[model samples]
Every structure is written in structure tokens, then in C-alpha cells.
Target: MNETENDYHGYTPMDYDEDSAADEAYQTCVSYIVEHAPIERDDTVVDVGTGTGIVALELASKCDRVLGRDIDDEWLRYAREKAAERGVENVSFDHGSFREPNVEEAVDVVVASYALYMAYDEGGEGTLRAAIEGISSLNPRHLVVADKMFFGPPEPRGGYETLPRMGTVANLLADTGFTLTDVEIVSGSAGVLVASRTSG
Candidate 1:
């Protein structure tokens, strides 16, 4: 398959029931965020590239409102339907990119699961900078990032490559004015990083 096809296939939603490993890792990441992040009642959150609303739905249960933004309209639609089916009224989904999110007001927390790394690899430093700038504009108190960690060179996958180490991610967050607070490595190679905005 070509690069485009590979990339598209990589992001194609999987059946959660069939993918036990992925599901477990996802749940672990969600639990880590809930325990470590500053997510609380009355807080508004934005889940960037929120595919199918897994993280968004989880946050909705804890926070007052959650907006799940993704570039895929199909995923956003599915997320909205899933929220409704689950009777989660505090969550909503929209079509947008993490580099240029569509949220208007300042949110209390921003969570990106396995999404920012794709942006970083696809667009390189420019996309990474854009993502940080966009998140900064929201003035969030906390940020949560979860992705696979590559100790060596990033290996090619379905459509993209793996991300750098947790240290690299921490430096990027620090460059964007966020202070690293916590990190958890799970499923062996996959990990989550939580950061808080530094006071000016």
C-alpha cells in the first residue's frame, strides 16, 4: 500500500472487543489521567484528535463538559453516537485538527491520546509548534499526552512512525511553557505524560 493508504488504514477504528491489548492500554491511560491530572468537577476539557470519544467519554464522567475534536467526520459522528448511547450528555464531538483546534473558550484541561505524535511526525517541528500554540491559546491548566515511546529510531508502521522517548516529549512540553508533572509507562512501550501550565 502507498503511504496514504497505510496511514488511513492505521487510523481505521478497531473493534474494541477484538483488540484486547489496545483496549487494556487505553483504559490504563485513561485511569492514569483521572488519577494524576487536575481534572475535576466544573472543569471543561478538550480532547484533541479524540477518536471515537474514548478519552472524552471518560473525562465527561469526571468533568462538567468535554469537547472531542478530530479530523475524521466519521469518527466524530461515531463519538457523538457513542456518547448518546452511553447516556453521556456532557460530551460533544467536532471535526477539527489538533494543530488548529476549533474550541472557542479557555478549557481547563486538554488531552491528546496517540494523536499529537502523529501530528509531530507528519508535519515535523512546524506541526508540533502549531499544536502547542493552539493548546496554549486555550489557556488550559493541565495537558495529558499518551503515545507509544520509541527508544531507538522510530520504526515505520501502518501509515506513520513511532514517537520519541518520554524525555523528548517532556522537553517539548517545557518549551511550550508547560511543566512536566507526571509520567507513566504502560503496556511496556506505550506511555502517558501529564503537564501543567507554568505561571507567567
Candidate 2:
């Protein structure tokens, strides 16, 4: 049992149940992405912000390989345990930011759920763009980002105010040369936006 530090929040995977609302939201978001991803058994997928590795593990069942990356490795450990318990051998984990992943190459599709909204700083827009570019640089067939979009001014939380509008992400993807192929919003839900790269 390895204990992770607080600075490594991304590594600390939150405990979730299949019956919980968060879990349900995660599944809903993932399902939409999977539907639009065009991933196959021979393709490789990467799930960013892969807390507990649920999305990654589930994806592995349908893809040839899957890598779940998080800032924290503690959650990754739990993901590994779940994978082991489920006998899912194709999924793995890494502790790092998608902005600067340590992988030697990019995978097929990048699934980022509720992660992009957390990307904020003085150069927030630039950071988000760079992160998207980093993923796009891998030449993946698809890039799926599920974020919390607000309709008005955002409330103060975790020292962040005025959350980035969902349109921001869509525009960023477009600025980075990604085509807006799909945009599906679940009524009465926070919302999950799916975008992808057009095949040349």
C-alpha cells in the first residue's frame, strides 16, 4: 500500500461506486465518447484524468490497449487493483499531466473526462491549448474532452472563479485544427462535449 502526497492530487483516485451519481456521470460521459471515438480492438486508447481507471479499464475491454494517465499514482494503484480483479490485462497507468505525458508516442484516442475544466492558470487559455496540442501532436484519430460548462459567472470554488465556458474548449479544439464533429448535451446534466480530428 503506497501513500501519495497531497501535492499529488491527480494520483489520488477518489473512491467511487457503480451506483453513485458521479460514477453514473462518468459512465454517461464515457459512453458518449466511446460511441464517437471509432476505437477498435486493434486500436490503442488513453484516458486522461483516469481516476480509479474505470474508463480506462472499460475501454481496454474494447480496444487492443489502453493507458490511463493521472497526476497521482495512488488512484492508479487502485485502478490497477480493479483491473486485476476484473482480469483486464490491457490497461495500464501513469502519473503525469496530459500536457506533458512521459510516453514515447501517442495512442489512438485521448479521452479526457472532467479534466480540462481543471486546467487553469494565468495563461489558462494557452495552457489548455497547449494541452490539446500535445494530445493532437500524438496524431490520434480522436480526442474526447468531457468538462463542466457553466451558463453564467462561475462561483468561487477551490480558488477558481468564472469557470471556462464549454465553448472555450470547442474553440480551442478548432484553433488547434481539430474538427467539431459532434456536440451532444445530456438534458439536465452538466454536459459532455465530444470533438475529433478529421481523417485526411
Candidate 3:
């Protein structure tokens, strides 16, 4: 393998199963997008924090094209291979950070899955601000964020007290000029928050 391929993030595409149960998580997220988005067949969608191209591949079928962006080159390679395996010609991957996406092309819809949370620390105040700005810079017609809020008792991985409440993020979105359009909680373990760009 080339050094570039090996030096990328630790993610190995082959390590992720295309048919894993986690795929249900992806599918659930996609369903939320199709439901809340004013998606059009001609729209070009961007899947920020796209891991293994799951959301990007799903969007490819519903949009004119789909681009998956991630900072990990290994994950990008894996995403490309997955796209190739599925013969999804309209889906592509780029090695970049969604927090500071570097793409010239504007998209119609931007979807950020669980990947957004990793960009922040406890409380996620700064992280949410950066995330909103990053998504806004894309100038997409809509922004969809799929994340989970921990409201349970304390645990080793940090519990509710260690994380920002969903309402905190909702307020952060408002402060950053995003209007909440829909909210959904899945399996009592995750919450999906969808919002649209609005003037500050």
C-alpha cells in the first residue's frame, strides 16, 4: 500500500461491514432526511463527516450527485471502494474535515451524522458554533444533523452531566441562524436534529 494510504486515519474500509447492524443507524438517518428535506432529484447533496459512504451512497439514489467528506484518508479510500463495489457512480469521497470543509461546489443538502459530536468536548458549545458556521459556509438549501444526546445516569464513558443537552444545541443553532424543522429520537439512544439556514 502507498504511504499516503497507510498514513491516513486508522480507519480501514474493509473493517466496516456494508451490511452491519450499524447500517440500520444509517438507514434511519436517511429516512429522516427524506422525510424532512425539501429534497429534489436534481439536488446535489453533501454528506459531511461521511463514514464509509453510508449516507452519501443513500443520498446518491435520491439526488443528482453526492459527495462524502472526511478528514481521514483511509476512510475516504474505504468509502471510494465501497462506492465502487456498489457501482454507485454518482457518489464520491474527499479527504477533508467537515468542520472546515474545503470544496468549491455548493450543495443543496448537507447531512452530518454522529461525526459532528467528535469535533467537540464536554458541553459542545464551541463545537456547535463551529459546526453551524461550517455547514452555513456550504450555502446548502438545508442542513441535517443526526446526533445522540445522553440523558442517562452517569457512566464510565461520561453520561448526561458530561454532555450538552439537546436544548443547548437547539439554542446554539438558533444563535447561528438555523431554524429547527424537525426532531426525532431513535431507540432511546439517539436523537436526530434537522434545521435549515436562516438569516442571523
Candidate 4:
């Protein structure tokens, strides 16, 4: 997993699920990403930071397939078990990080929830740049990022070092052939960004 401001090492998969279920802002981000993303019925989607595969599983019903990639094995195991229990055959969780998302085929859309800041924490903007580029390589037409990124000035609830500003994030996406199309601020320190692939 990318270096993160908070660690999930102590929490069981069920515990993580319960906490995220209780977090209104986090839920808002997930909903906003799904609602705003330009996904088609036949599209294949890749969730770059699929912690417990929540976002990936959510998108599975709407899209043809969803591949949830994360670096955490425990989380993937739990996610897969949940998928089985729910009979969600269209979604799968596998090991991957933002910079190396092990995507074997092309995808129509890409989504990331609360993972980009961890990229920054791992190696600053440099790592984030690589992560964006990596996602771009999948040839997705649309990208949605929901995380504790700043839509305004850094807030007290977020860390200055890890909370990336929207402007910087947009510039990095632009460098990778994307145009920042829309934004939804879910809370003081959390938001969603919708970007579309565009010619440079």
C-alpha cells in the first residue's frame, strides 16, 4: 500500500467496512464519483485503489465489469469473499497500486477513491504524476478521483503535506492527456474530481 496518513493495519476488513459505512463524507464521495463519471452500460471499469472493493463493487452492476485493484491482500480477500456472498460475478479484486495497476486489458473508465493522497505520501507529487500516467495508460476515456484532496486552501482536518490541491492535481492530469471537467466537494477535506481524456 502507498504510504498513507492513516494506517488500516489494525482494522479487520469488516471493521474497515463498518467505519466507511458510517462515514457520510466518504459515502458521498463514492456516490458522486459514480454519478458523475461518464460510464456506459457496456464499459469496463478499473478501480485503482480498491480498498475493500467498495467502489468497484458498487460500479459492477452499472457497468459490464469492474476490476478493483489494491496492494493489500487482506482487503482483496475480504472483497472477493463479499463478492461471492453477494453473487457479484462481474467484479474482482486483485493486488495493484496506482503506479502499477496490473490491468491486462483496456478499460472505458477508471475510478479511485481516497488513494491519490497516499500516492503523494509515498513519494510526493512525483509519485502522483506517475500514478496519473499509469492510469492514463489504460486508455480510459473518463477518470474519477475521490479523496481527501483540497478543493480550497489546506484545512485543519487535512495534512498540508499529503492533501494535494486541486490545481496541482489538474495540472498533473493535464500532463497525462486529461482535462479536468468537474468537481464535487464532499467535505472540508474530501472531494471528487472528474477528468476526461483529451488531446494535448
Candidate 5:
């Protein structure tokens, strides 16, 4: 396994569940992303950085198919295990990343939570832009991003100094042909952004 896979506080696939179990904000973000993704019964949804397939599994019933992508192969394995244990057939977990989701040329919707920062926090601002643009290129009609982001003064929190700013992401989305339609601020630093494709 890659050392960077768990470098973010030694997070294993199980820890994602455990963390949400312990952090209300985290769970809120996760649930909110699934509930407000604008997924249709015939839609195909791709979830980036799908740590353990929690969101992918929950969304399978709402969409025709769900693709869960993660940089860590172990996380994908764990996600597959969860899908099997839950008898979720429409969701597939695979190796992918925020920068290269490995999805089809077009999808109905793309959703990510507690994962976007991996683009910025790990790779910096340019990577974050590429990540968002990559998702835009998928031609998904909508995007739902939920993570610990700055809603106020930009400052380090939870030991992460490069948290994405809500405004910055919104601007990038708009530049990439998406428009912000809704936002749910779970906390000062945790929130969800819902945007729709407006051009092309």
C-alpha cells in the first residue's frame, strides 16, 4: 500500500466510518451530499475519492449506476467489501483520484465529500483546479462537494492549512461551466456546495 494512502492521519478505510461516527459535522456532510445530489433514476453518478463507498452505496438506489473512485486500492477493496456485505450491485468501487476520476466521458452527476482537499492539501492549488476541471470535463449535469472548507477567514484547522475555500471552488466551477445552485454550511469550516452545469 502507498504510504500517502494513509498519510492523512493514518486513515484507513475503516477510519472513515469511525470518524463520521464520531464527528457529527462529517456525517452531516456525507449525508447531505447524498441527499441533495440531484440524482435521477436513470442517471450515472461518479463519486471521487470515495473512501469506503459509503456515499456510493447510499446513492446506488437513486441512480442507475454509481462509480466510486479512490486513490488507495485498499480503500477500493474495502468499499467493494462493503458493497458486497450490503448487497449493493449497482455501485462499483475502483482505483481513481480527484485528479483523474477514470470515469466515462459523460455522467449525470458527480459527488464528492471530505475528499476535495486531497487535491489541494496534498498537491496544492493548481492540482485543486485540475481536479475540479477534470470533473467538469466529465459533463456531469451537477456537482456536489462536501468537505471542511473555509467559510470565513482562511486559517488552518484540524491541522490542515490548505483547506479549499468555498468561494474559490465556486468560482472554479463557474469558470468550468457550472453554476452554484445551493449551499449548506454545516459549520464554519465544513459545508456542501451544489452546482449545476450552465454552459456546454
Candidate 6:
């Protein structure tokens, strides 16, 4: 199950069951972000590559607004539908890539859960640099990133081999002018990092 073969775009369902592992992972990532990043009520957040409103909707509950951005129209529609179903008024879904998020205002926080590394893997160096720059342009106070960590072998996922190590990710954030605040790697080989802008 190389990454190309098991890519979410190819095989993973657009939506996950309420209690499935995928849903749990989403919840776990959101929980970690909320705990470490601590969004304020007056803050606006952007959940980049937010599939099905998982992180976006959750952030909406704690912030003034949340924009869920993704390149997949189907996933965006599903996120919109889910937000409507939950009567979550502060959350909005939009079709966009992380490299060019098209957000209108400076957001207080930007979160990418299991999404940024995928952009790095698929789009290569240029995309990753663009993504970092795009996020920086938002002038976010905090940036929370959550993605898988390969401890040994490339766990059957297509691009795990290309996924940057946790330290490498931290270095990238530093290069983009963010200060690393906290980091944690879960037993499941997934990790979360929180970084803050010096001026923010």
C-alpha cells in the first residue's frame, strides 16, 4: 500500500464514520491544537486542507470564525453540508490549495492536520515553500501542524519516504520566521507542532 496506491484522494472515503479511527485521529489532532494553540473567542482561524470540516468545525466552536480550505470540491461540499447540519454558523468551506489559500483577512491561527506534508510530498519543494509563505502572509499568531512521523520503514503510505522529519519540520517553521513553542509525537506515529510568530 504505497502512498500512491492508498492515497486519500484515491481510496480513503471523503467522509468518515463518527467513531472510526479516521474520525478519532481528526478529533485527536483538533484536541491537541486547541489545547496547545488556545484560540481566543475573538480570533479567526483557517484550517488549511481541512477535509470534511473536521478541524475547521471544531475550531468554529472556540473562535469567532473558521475557514476550511481545501482543493477538493467534493470534500468542501461535504464540509459545508456537515457545518449546516450541525448549525455551526461560524464555519465556512472554500475550495483552495494551501499554497494560495485566498483568505481575505489576517487570521489569528492557521492549522494543518495531516495535510501539509501531503502537499510537500506531492508538490515537491516549490509547493512546500509556497505553502509556508502563504501561511506566513496570513500573519497568524499561531501555526499548528499535525502529520504522521515515520519511525522506521515507510509504512506503506506512498510518500512517507519523502515526509520531513519532526526536526526538519521545526526547522522549516523557523526558517519561515516562526518560533517553535511545543511538539508532541503520539504513539501512533503521528505528531503535532505548535509555532508562533515573534511579532504576534
lDDT of each: 0.74, 0.67, 0.69, 0.84, 0.81, 0.73
List ranges where model 1 is wrong by over 4 Å: 1-23, 151-160
Question: Residue 26 of candidate 5: its Cα lDDT?
Answer: 85
Best by lDDT: 4
lDDT of 2 by residue, 70-97 (tens): 7766667888898998998888888756
Q: List the residue pairs that clash in candidate 5.
A: none
Between the candidate structures 3 and 6, which one is better when assessed by lDDT? 6
Which of 1 and 2 is ahead in lDDT?
A: 1
Residue pairs of candidate 4 with colliding backbone atoms: none
lDDT of 4: 0.84
Decide which is better by lDDT, 2 or 6.
Answer: 6
Question: Distance (Å) between predicted and true CA of 168, model 4?
Answer: 1.0
In candidate 3, which residue pairs clash?
none
Candidate 3 wrongly placed segments (more than 4 Å): 1-11, 18-27, 34-36, 151-162, 187-189
Off by over 4 Å in 6: 1-26, 123-126, 150-161
Q: Write the per-residue lDDT of candidate 4 for residues 29-100, one digit (tens) a residue.
A: 988876777889999999988878888888888999999988888778989999999999999888887778
Candidate 1, clashing residue pairs? Answer: 7-159
* Candidate no. 6 TM-score: 0.83
Of 3 and 5, the candidate ranking higher by TM-score = 5
By TM-score, the candidates rank as 4, 5, 1, 6, 3, 2
RMSD of 5: 2.3
The TM-score values for the models, in the order shown, are 0.84, 0.80, 0.80, 0.92, 0.91, 0.83
In model 1, where is the ten-residue run with the lowest total lDDT? Answer: 1-10
lDDT of 5 at 114: 82
Q: Give me the displacement of residue 194 in model 4, in angstroms.
A: 0.6
User: What is the lDDT, from 0 to 100, of the residue 160 in candidate 3?
Assistant: 26
Residue-level lDDT of model 5, residues 75-98, one tens digit each, is 888989999998899999877776
